[model samples]
Target: MNRPSLTWKLYIGAFYLFLFAPLLVVAVFAFNASPFPSPPWRGFTLEWFTGSGSIAGKPGVLVDPIWLESIGNSFRVAIPVALLAVLLGTVNAWVLERAEFRGKTFVAMMMLWPLVIPGVVLGISILAFFSRVANGLEDWLQTDLDFLRPGLPLVVLGQLSFILTIATLIIAARLRKFDRSLEEAAFDLGASRARVLRTVTLPFLKPALIGAGLVALLMSFENFNTTLMLVGSVAPLPITMYGQMREGASPAINAVSLLLMLGVGGIASVFALTSKAER
Candidate 1:
């Protein structure tokens, strides 16, 4: 076996630093006492992290309704996007893996097509298509369908257009590993197809399904390029952060980042502890 060269180790270290340096900066600045997000640290402070009244000297972010509302809106968009993506993806994965049909390969390719499309282009396409459809409906109904305009649902649709492909691929990969013999045995035992699927197939796919939903949730929350175009009157966390930056806002953004990082870290720690206990 060959060992990696010293140059290769150095390259790997540099790559990791490049990936994590910004995150480290963000985390560090979240505790900076200065209102500014960057440099010449004033002092360590938790004002941003805890929100309003966290520090008596200034208005705290915790009590800021705008940020709180944006976070709430982010969840509203993310949850639905994840659910819709997972639902569509699971169904697509099931059909692709288990059912034989004409143009199956083509159908699979089409499902995956959005993954390759640039998010901005995809957003534009969805907006145009949805608007046209909504307009046509309005023409027939002779009334308004204002909900069809850019907002949470539109953002969800834009994100789902591609996020579903990721979930589909993940679930499909998991499904491919399933033991068909178990499904067959259930059928041989006079189990109806639906019954066998519910008892055996779904249980086998549960871990994958859960994983896909988690991935979709994260992606939907983080999605920006596609979401930016589709979000008109409302904003998600990422977009909210962008707006704050445009206004020359302070380290509250970093504080939000730190809070999110902590949340993710907490979850990971729990999983780690659970795994170690099981082991």
Candidate 2:
């Protein structure tokens, strides 16, 4: 094959630059000694990541309670959201792929509605619907439905609205490629349906399950629109960072961005390795 032309090389270079140049800038600024995440690079320092209150007169991202709490909140929402989304998505995939049910096409299309809806719209809809339900229940029964309020539970549900669809798609794609003969053979060998599913089907779907869970985790962690609408007193990392940015840009924000990059990169790496091993 002929070598790539200069124009092709230039296009590829530009594409990657567009994709990663901003991230590179953020990574660089995370180490900047200056207060702001901008140039006139002051000498490098670890203040953004590790400064003590007394030494730098400002706490670092690791030591700051706001950042720490926000980070904790993010994991709190993301872990459960990932687990539930994957579990439900797996069930949905199995039913859609295996069960010959009426209105199956309609059900599949309806499940995809969440994926097509804008995040802002999904967030607003969940918030409004839950708020109304909470009000109605309180009026009728004089009971408080605290879970329906704009808090971590609402935030988890909001993220799940769309994330579940994504997980379903991922798992269903794998399920579609599965050979029914494997299940048939197992059944002929006297294995129970549950045993066949647990041993053969689940083993085959492991990669897809893991991939969907990791993707869901990352999406929930980075989600801002739905979280913003549904979050109560406790904010996730993305929400906290947004508030910080609105006040003023700071190197500390850069530090957080860098950490996020590392985290997302790590997850992606794990997925890649898992996929490779499966292959």
Candidate 3:
């Protein structure tokens, strides 16, 4: 292998710095003793992550009710979104990659349309469509549908709109490379279609499914634009953090950012390891 030139090495270093500098700053600030997440560091302290509100009235991320509730809501939305997206995405992937049908290309394009649309537009579209449905139902059925209102369900649906496309793409990429002979061999051994799917196909797709699910989880957890439009009285972590920043940032926000970084990094690491193991 040819060695990289000095200039190329410097370029790579600069690229990495640009990518990670902000993250490094956030992580460093998370440990800062100061109330604000800025320069002129007061000193090193775990106050942001573990301090009591009594200590200068600055509550830690773990102890703060707002942060806890928002984090919980983010998880509440993300788990369902990831599960539903992965389940539906797997079916879509199978249909797109395995089954032959008329207008297959068109169907695939339509399924992926959510990804091309801006997040704000997708959120607003879902909001409007559902609100209209809710209003019509109220007039027709003489009752309200709370689920149709702006809430966790809507937030989950909004995130899933684009996330489903991502999950489909991930699973489809893996499914495309799957060997059909394995399924044929199982059939030759008199395994039923369901059994083949259960024992062989699902196992083969496990890594991809896991990857898609984790990516979906991360995306759902961090999602803001779509969630912002559909969120109910309770906000997700991103929306909560945005609110805090707008009012005034605290070092606790940096702590939350660091935790998010760790979470996202852990998911990426798992995906990498799973892919490597599968290979």
Candidate 4:
């Protein structure tokens, strides 16, 4: 193996430092034993991680109720969104790969357009469309529908619009390598189409499906820009963190952010390791 030159090593180190310096600083300040969480580093302490503080004369300290509520809401939204996206996306991928039809390419392109469109634009469009639809339904049916109210269902719908695209793409990439002859052989041996799919095709696609579902779940959980616009009165964890930072960044917020980052990083690492092991 060729040894990396001094200049190359320095460049690589600098790149990694640039990438992680802010995260390191945030982690450090999260444990700083100071009144203010910012500059002029003092001794290290873990009190902030468990204690509370008053913000703008509000009698709340340590773990903020609003922040915790938002985090719970985020999980509520993400879990359903991930499940729905995986089910819909996996079916879409299977149909696109297994069936031949006119306009198939056009349909695929339309499905993928969400991945290229800006998140803010997509959020606005979905909000507008839903608003119009809800209004029309109210007028025609003469009844109020609570589904359009700003809450879990709306959040899931907004996220699924884009996250399903990601799941579809990931599963589709793996499907491209699949052997159609396996299905053909199953059919030749008297297996029905549904039986072939359930036994043969789905088994082969399991790993990719799991990986894609996890990716979609993470993306939905961490989403900010789109979720912020569509969240209405309910805030997700990212939105809560943003609000906290805007008001006055506390060490607790930093601790929460670090914990979330570590959780996500750990899950991704495990997924990667398992994938490699399977290969």
Kindly indicate the candidate among 1 and 3 with the higher TM-score.
3
> What is the per-residue lDDT of model 1 for residues 1-279, given as tens digits with 9 covering 90 to 100?
399999999999999999999999999988888868778988887777574654544455566777788889988987997788778888999888989999999998898798789999999999999899999999999999877888888898889889999999988988898989999999999999889988998987776676777778778877889999899888888898898889885788788877778766764565456435432
| Highest lDDT model number | 2
Q: Taking the candidates one at a time, how many backbone clashes does each contain?
A: 6, 0, 0, 5
lDDT per residue, candidate 4, 43-156, as tens digits?
A: 877666555454323212246677678878988998898888888988898777877999999998899888888888887887788888989999999999767855667778
Candidate-wise lDDT, in order: 0.83, 0.93, 0.92, 0.81
Q: On residues 60-167, what C-alpha lDDT tens digit does candidate 2 reach at each position?
A: 999999899999999999999999989999999988898898999999899988977889999999999999999999999988899999999999999999999999
For model 3, give the 10-residue run with minimal summed lDDT: 50-59
The lDDT, on a scale of 0 to 1, for candidate 3 is 0.92
TM-score per candidate, chains pooled: 0.90, 0.95, 0.95, 0.89
lDDT of the structure predicted as candidate 1: 0.83
Give me candidate 1's TM-score against the actual structure. Answer: 0.90
Stretches of candidate 4 exceeding 4 Å from the true structure? 1-8, 52-63
**Best of the two (3, 4) by lDDT:** 3
